[model samples]
Target chain A: MMIPTPSALAYVPFVSVANMMRLVHSLGPEHFLSELAAYIEEDFRRWPDFDKTPRIASHSRDGVIELMPTADAESYGFKYVNGHPKNTRTGHQTVTAFGVLSSVATGYPLLLSEMTLLTALRTAATSALVGRYLAPEGARVMALIGNGAQCEFQALAFRALCGIGTLRLYDIDPGATAKAARNLRAQGFDVTECRDAIQAVEGAQIITTCTADKQYATILTDNMVGAGVHINAIGGDCPGKTELHRDILLRADIFVEYPEQTRIEGEIQQLDPDHPVTELWQVMRGTVEGRRNARQITLFDSVGFATEDFSALRYVADQVRGTDFHEPLDLMADPDDPRDLFGMLMRARDA
Target chain B: MMIPTPSALAYVPFVSVANMMRLVHSLGPEHFLSELAAYIEEDFRRWPDFDKTPRIASHSRDGVIELMPTADAESYGFKYVNGHPKNTRTGHQTVTAFGVLSSVATGYPLLLSEMTLLTALRTAATSALVGRYLAPEGARVMALIGNGAQCEFQALAFRALCGIGTLRLYDIDPGATAKAARNLRAQGFDVTECRDAIQAVEGAQIITTCTADKQYATILTDNMVGAGVHINAIGGDCPGKTELHRDILLRADIFVEYPEQTRIEGEIQQLDPDHPVTELWQVMRGTVEGRRNARQITLFDSVGFATEDFSALRYVADQVRGTDFHEPLDLMADPDDPRDLFGMLMRARDA
Candidate 1:
């Protein structure tokens, strides 16, 4: 049997929200987490081969819009994302994203996906992957602070990747914590609802702060954090937005994905410009140590990088290879004669 | 009776190639050209309000992919474009583009349109808009060098905006020149196909050079370009790619859209870094002189800019409003509760 080639040159594959969810379920959420982690790790292992740049941001009075672009030798990917905390008040997603993965040779898009869900998945996968290296050996309990859209995914990823069994969830809004707890309960997780951040962190070996605040508000204070616990800080991803207290950052050994970007947008932005931080890629590459002593506080200050999104796109492109979950979108114009674009447009009138 | 509000917040309008062609024909090509020229001129008149930056380009071995993003206080727009000279052999456009216009207040995309056709239209509009200021009085004949996809658009734009009725066309490939002549003649232009580049410039008041080559090429030598001709050079838009002879640039008083970008990407790259050049926006804004004397050579270095795409997207968005030419696209994930994105996915699974 002759294998058919993908018509990517003429039609770009698009994975909508419904299709993305179906794809994730088809892979089984836990298996998908591990597979995505592997792709991310594979890219991280050869980190220097890809083009890395801080995301381009357009700031507004209420929120910010950003375009994150990166490319390897074979593929180019970019994500368009918006962060509007006030959007929730108007019944709109606070953070909605879409991405395109394209051929480097042809400069044509191959896969376009709704990245809002994928971003949450990859972020959790990355955090859990880091936890695999940096967390205490055989860690079981995780304190998930600021329970919102990302709370349940982080819980499942940690359970699947880091061997965590219990999730202690807390949010300022009791309704958010209740929603996450209900979701985790359905997924067979040992869920604990806490009254406050301090209560959530008790008896937890891993602590994750994924709040959606646009200010420098601390969800984790220095006193609440103890030694030997891994801190996954995902909320402090833009200028003037930080989750951990400055004192907590001073106490921890910081590891980051792209320190140049992390220093500007991560929790490290609160510290000195010259504050030493090891790149997570180096640790994943095994050139640098992840966890040293029993009492060492290893903090992953992840201001999400483009490579992670690229990996997520790679995952989606792979999962939907021969499936019906994706549809082709005629996003680019192709003509019989490249120089005859006007002729093509003119002929469209007859067609 | 209750009035219905536009469902803009729920759906983004998408203008496909068929729809864009229909839109162009609906307004009649010449009238559409004049209206697009007016929009381009309006944005140029208020150029200071725009957030201008050189396009972010990802250069490959064969070509380049670029993202041009810009924003005003109320609206944001961006274009994804690519240039692959060798793509024509594979039946693909050398230049393919798409763009999005969004609300700055909500960070929601309002319109997504294929920019391949709009780009051609706006490039012609901008060229003609500039020719109106720089071209000599009673200019009726234009020398169109390097006739390619942009050839006919340039021809008609000059006719609509600058009162040019005759076109002298020449290309290295006679087939391309023939194609352009055939297209222009059908549009009622007095088209004359010239034997060589030197022959094409004879008795022409305005000259447009729009070849697609990734090299330092001289389609117009210093000796070929006479005084008092407004040269619209649109081909040399990347690093190490220039169309005019360096000596031609020495004699011409060059005008550009953005000096910071034009110095790096336009024909002026061959000149001194601090070489004095006038901003075309300033000329349109009445802050600088356009044509000082009849004998002075004026060259408009037209490397495409972000604001022109902004204007094109703006025009398409306006023209397609309440019309069937554009269909609503569910490009964004608009959940009922922004914080409950995961819940939305779960609900979709059930539905």
Candidate 2:
């Protein structure tokens, strides 16, 4: 019997989020979310194969801009993102992002996509993935503080991935809470709009603080966070942007994406530099126990890492293949004679 | 009397080299070269106003890639470039680059252009600018070593800026020499193809070395160099990639764009860490001397820096405005509601 060899044509075509969304809608959001969750989990399992670094950030007066770059042996990926807390006052999203994926062997960019939408989706996916292991079993109610642009995505991801069915939302800006409630209602979610953080946390199994203040304002106090609650803190992402009170952090068993990055940018930045925190990967790898007791409070202090973007880029690329949503960009030159760079220009001029 | 306000449209549109060449060809190359040289000189005089740093580079097995970023309070610029010495053997360009200029206040990308061609132009322009200050008055001939992709541009810029009337050229690859000779002859230059490096430098007032090897290969030795020669060392741009011998550096008064960078990536890499060198800005500022005596050999260790790209970007953006050569690029989203990034996506989806 003759065996057939795998052809070079086995490569998946790249998919932009616009294209991926259409495919996702066609596949139904529930199925797509499940597949994305699986992809994230699988990637976390092979985390050691990646070349990782705490992102290179350039800070400005108003906010901070950062480039998070990572690569494995086969592919390279990076995201350009910014955070300006005061931006929302001017009716602008506090966070905006874009990313590029390239082939490591050739160093040629294969896909360039507007990552603003994908970032929201991936952050939610990662939180949900962590929640699967760290959250209390059959957790159904989440207290969501700071119901801004990312609130609906977080609620939907939890509802779909962790069987969370109801949301208790609170925001300083009542308009933002209303907007989040409207968006979640459109997505078939049941939300209770609360007047205060304490009321929002009442009978909640998960407390998610996604506020956008640049300063260390406590959106969550220790008295508000109850036992067996998974605190998904997302807003306190920079050096001075803490949302949860110090007492709450001291009380909860914390897990982070990357310890070095979390120590600087995550909620743990409020704690001592030498404070013990478990890496989320260790929990996923079964090296550390997560939510070991029924009443133990668990915290996923996710400030977002490059590895999550890498996984998102990989999934988006795989999903976009054979779709009409992307254009082949002339980002790299594949000249017949590479040394004759001038010759290529001369030809372009002549043509 | 009522004073009329100036039109509030002072934005500069960016043009890539391909488009700039079209605009230049229409305006004439002589005018473009002279104007660009003037702009470079003017920017050099105000160098203290700019923020400068040595590029952040990522090294790989085949070659190295780098991100050179710089900014003033008004504008920010960065270039992504890669140098793979073995790339040409596999039908790829040894150097490939692209750059972007953005508004510092808004953090919006204003221009995106291919820099593979512009790099050659800017590098040549920089060399000629340095030669104008360091070379002996009315120098007429330049010995062009390593007649490759960049040789013609150097020759043209020198001819245009420094009153260089003749060229003496030599390269290990005879075909490259022939190509350079043919191209220069078309441009009405007096070209002499010499047998070796020594013969090429025998009667020249300036010697320009631009060979592309990724090792410490001495293309120009101290014995081959003579007194009063202004050497434009252009090719040795990474660690372990020096062209001129150590003794040559010892004999010459080395000037560099950024000393911190040149110490590691330029020909000065061969010298001691404590070796004395002058920054070119200081020379332009008259704080340091360029050439004290006619017999003093001066070297412009031109590894290339980010500030040069900033100058070039500003120059190109200014020249392309009010012309048909550039198309307005929508690289950044200026939503009426900046906080509603998701709203922008919804708009795009609806469109």
Candidate 3:
């Protein structure tokens, strides 16, 4: 009598961040941004197919750490991110992130990439994607408040995607503004270093706030807001974190990514839960008015969502498929007999 | 004017699973298990420090994937795990898992370890830990029902931790029982192969049912159980999946890991939502009696929790330290200028 043997399984593929960066850089920023935007738009159009939930967050006295996970039938994606306002004091990025993209069918991870760089790229890309509908046509100047790690990416993305030629930058830390100004100048943008947030927003067609403070400080007051200005509020992403004043939200036509989540995490937290806000996808699909009038104040309460990471992962996976930039890791075990997980370990031990 | 420079940050450490195994093997399994038990006990003693949430699960037609996340003020941890009963048909393990341990202050992943192997070890260790308090003293014979991938680890842990000398194994597939018998025989356990579940549970003081079907199939009915039988119900871990009939739960004095989670995911899902169940910790801490009499049926509804992974990760971290098994990956960028996240890319590009 012969004993039954376990069958063999195939190995899953994994792409590390270093390799992913090489893949994205080799593909060129323009192509990557364009492809990522297209992917984001596509996924947004099929929003109902996703399993969406408000991100799970762990909060402490000093910072907040969050896990954003979303899945469709075919793929699963998640990002691990943190927000520490005092991290810069210890010479660290205030926010650092990494993400994984996996095959939902097999529950095997396909890509593990450093989202620090990708997050900056995706946030800028998402802002620009929303700006296409919300920002007035021929918009040239963008007031960039909180000139920190994210400012240069925002400037460059708008330059490439929104045709912005100039930036008005301000920060409480003069050094941060100086860094943004220098980086923008090197990237060939006409940069103005403003002394105050009011000076920065003055006469700018679009205003973006990406500050790192964990307070409800009003960076943009109602009086500083001008007509026809597109407000991309990026920094106010957690509870008690807000850049735009409550009056600004009340006056502007507010837009959000996920209404259920935005109600708790975005600038919309300052507004009533019953306050009507249009989703960005509705505006992108022409189901809702984006900028009703040339002079209307349009707000994009840009709290990052898992869907954006899903799109970014998909785009990265597609761009890196045939490229030599990915190095596969032996992350999963494929044994000749699947039931013999113990056998595989014994073999490894012996070998 | 000087060109403002980007800030650089400090590096974070990452220990992968392959490295962790090599480290653990070098440390020896006995020492590792002892240390793991100590870590788990220590963490359980200070359970209030953790910010715990019930795992978020996404169930599919075939299987279920879950994200278990938890954190304290100092460290953060999460595990991505999947349970697919049909995976064995395609020559895959019924369960696979991986986890990350990160710093709360820096938000960088410190360790990325495979929990497939670790899960087996930790589950066995946990079962044995509970057995020490709940099982009858001098319990020598254990009936291991559904002898699949987890059988060997359970046998070994009981032998090491709970002084169990013999295992009576049974599976619907005789091949699985044969495999478990062979594995345990080599591991120096007195193993008896049984034709049916009733025969397997006949003389054993502890009965462990870890079947892998995703349905409400009862492996143990009320009539089959006897007094002083400590039951570890391991596999009926999702909604609509259970090992014991409703009568079995009613007859047994039930204990669980986390009441809120176990009420939904464990075998207690078959019971009423407000069914009287004592937490295992209460027993461990002497706050409640484990077994009132020799003939009482004590059921442990073992739905895995994040706190267990947190304990396992902490144990692995301690064991792997000062060993030559870990290969450090440059996972987090520690640029000299914190604001110069862009500078890290430029440096990498230049290098």
TM-scores, all models, native as reference: 0.96, 0.89, 0.96
Can you give the lDDT of residue B228 in candidate 2?
91
DockQ, each predicted model: 0.61, 0.25, 0.50
The reply for model 3, stretches above 4 Å from the true place, is A1-17, B1-14
Candidate 2 residue-wise lDDT, B107-178, digit = tens: 545665656666877888899989988998769999999887788888888988899979999999998898
True contacts kept of 1: 0.58
Judging by lDDT against the true structure, name the best candidate.
1
Looking at model 2 chain B, report the run of 10 residues with the lowest lDDT sum.
B1-10
| Candidate 1 wrong stretches, greater than 4 Å | A1-9, B1-10
Candidate 2 Cα lDDT to native: 0.76
Query: Model 2, which residues run further than 4 Å from truth?
Result: A1-39, A88-92, A333-336, B1-24, B27-34, B37-43, B328-337, B342-351
Model 1 Cα lDDT, one tens digit per residue, A1-351: 212221345467878766887888777888999999999999999999998888889998888988889999999899888888788787777787888898887787888788888998999999999999999887899999988888888988898898898999999999999988887888788999999999999999999999998999989989999989999998999998999999998989999999888988999999999999999899999999999987999899988999999999998999999999998766676666678777776666555
Task: Kindly list the per-residue Cα lDDT of model 2 for residues A125-242, writing each as its tens digit.
Answer: 8899999999998789999998877777787788878989899999998988887777677667788999999999999999898988789899988888888889999998888889
- Interface RMSD values, listed in order for every candidate: 1.5, 3.8, 2.1
Evaluated against the true chain A, what TM-score does chain A of model 3 have? 0.94
Fnat for candidate 3 (0 to 1): 0.32
